[model samples]
Target: MSSRFKMSDLGLLCFYLGIEVQQGHDGIKLLQSAYARKILERAGMGSCNPCHTPMEHRLKLSKASTTAPVDATKYRGLVGCLRYLVHTRPNISFAIGYVSRFMEQPIVEHLNAVKRILRYIAGTLDYGCHYKHGG
Candidate 1:
């Protein structure tokens, strides 16, 4: 490609966007602990208790469900950050997607759901995808 456009070597990629890349004999491991922690901090859940799962199993959310309303802007912002986080943490994809549906008119229940996700993230900060050389 050097023959086409001018480009210089930026050295081995250790970080890109918010993902952290680690190289070793076994394989390459991608992490996003920093990004996850920042999300928790932004949501004011930095010291929150960790949870086993991203969201409660069998949890169902509906717009018609009566509940106190929450700040739509804040709720949407959290969901947006979670969406970006899905790039390296697919485990929370479903949970984030489920809670995102209420961004237009998020309620207290939805906010709680979002907080649960943050708690789950706190427990799994080191969790990420590892691409083995051969598996």
Candidate 2:
């Protein structure tokens, strides 16, 4: 790919495709800390209390018979962006993947759950995956 196309060397990738990369002695760490913070601030969760987990342990989302009401478009957009972040940051992969299952008909409970994930990200902003330097 590089042989065919001329590409400028950007030096150690601090930011790319919206994800932040930090180089350390041990490895390269990928994070969406700033992005997550911005999302929370936009969603009015910037100063909200933090939670241990993104969603309640027993959350069972579905196009269900019993679900609270919320904005579908907003919910889908949130899930979609979160999915994009999962590419470089796999820490929230499972949580985001689970909520994505109900994007077609997201409810208030689902939206709240997604916000919770955002808040959790707010608290754990430093959490990310590490790739060994020499690997």
Candidate 3:
């Protein structure tokens, strides 16, 4: 409260910590398109083909799968970024959560799965939830 600590008005919040905010008559909207793009670039998938779905249906991933191991640190970093993006992109939450389970021992297949997610993000960069003033 102003009665307590001194504070300055920052005006309407449009962007913060990578999340984009928009205000209008309908309501406020939030998205992370910029953040998602950065993720794709970090993984060298900025120009990858877009996918309709985040992950293929009936997909199954297990540690027993015989695949070459990937860089644990890199995989973890990507997954971590994706997790933060989930705040404004819940559509990819399930996919990210699924692949994150292998952070300790990521494989080539897991990396591919992550790439698929990035591709999906590319196709749906404008996809985000809109909160109307009233239900």
Candidate 4:
């Protein structure tokens, strides 16, 4: 593909798509901080207070809730973005999964739960995994 398209060398990769890559002697580090931040901005929570945890412990969302329903499209979009972040943020996997269950019929409660995850992401933007050089 490179030969056919006459692609030029771009040197080391720093950012790709939404993931940031850092190469070093020990290993490679991947991060999606920018994408996470974008998600918040899209949700209009760029300057929101960060949360210590993505979700409350043992928190449960109901499908048959009495609370007012929120916008399904917006809720799904946020949840989908969070799911993409799971590639590098396993910490929020459970919480994202829990909130995702209400995507079809998200309520204010579910939206709040998802917002908590976003707030948690805001606090941990620089957090990412470092893979050691493998043999």
Candidate 4 C-alpha lDDT tens digits along 8-109: 888999998788999999999999999998999999999999989999888877999789999899999999999999988888899988998888888999
Candidate 1 lDDT, 1-135, residue by residue in tens: 989999999888999998999988999989999999999999998999999999898998889877889889999999999999999899999999999899999999999999999999999999999899988
* Candidate 3 Cα outliers beyond 4 Å, as residue runs: 1-6
| lDDT, each prediction | 0.92, 0.80, 0.90, 0.91
After superposing candidate 1 on the true structure, give the runs of residues whose Cα lies further than 4 Å from its correct spot: 1-8
Residue-by-residue lDDT tens digits, candidate 2, 3-57:
9999888778798877888988998888877877777776777888888887788
Looking at model 1, report the run of 10 residues with the lowest lDDT sum: 60-69
Give one digit per residue, the lDDT tens place, for model 3 in 1-135: 988989999999999888899999999999988888888899998888998999989788888778899999999999999999989888788999999898988899898888888889999998777899987
Error of 1 at 18 (Å): 1.2
Poorest 10 consecutive residues by lDDT, candidate 3: 58-67
Give the RMSD in angstroms, all C-alphas superposed, for model 1. 1.7
Model 1: residue 1 alpha-carbon error in angstroms: 6.0
Model 4's lDDT to the true fold?
A: 0.91
> Is 2 or 4 the stronger prediction by lDDT?
4
TM-score of each: 0.92, 0.82, 0.92, 0.91
How many backbone clashes does every candidate have?
0, 0, 0, 0
Instruction: Name every residue pair that clashes in candidate 1.
Output: none
TM-score, candidate 1, is 0.92
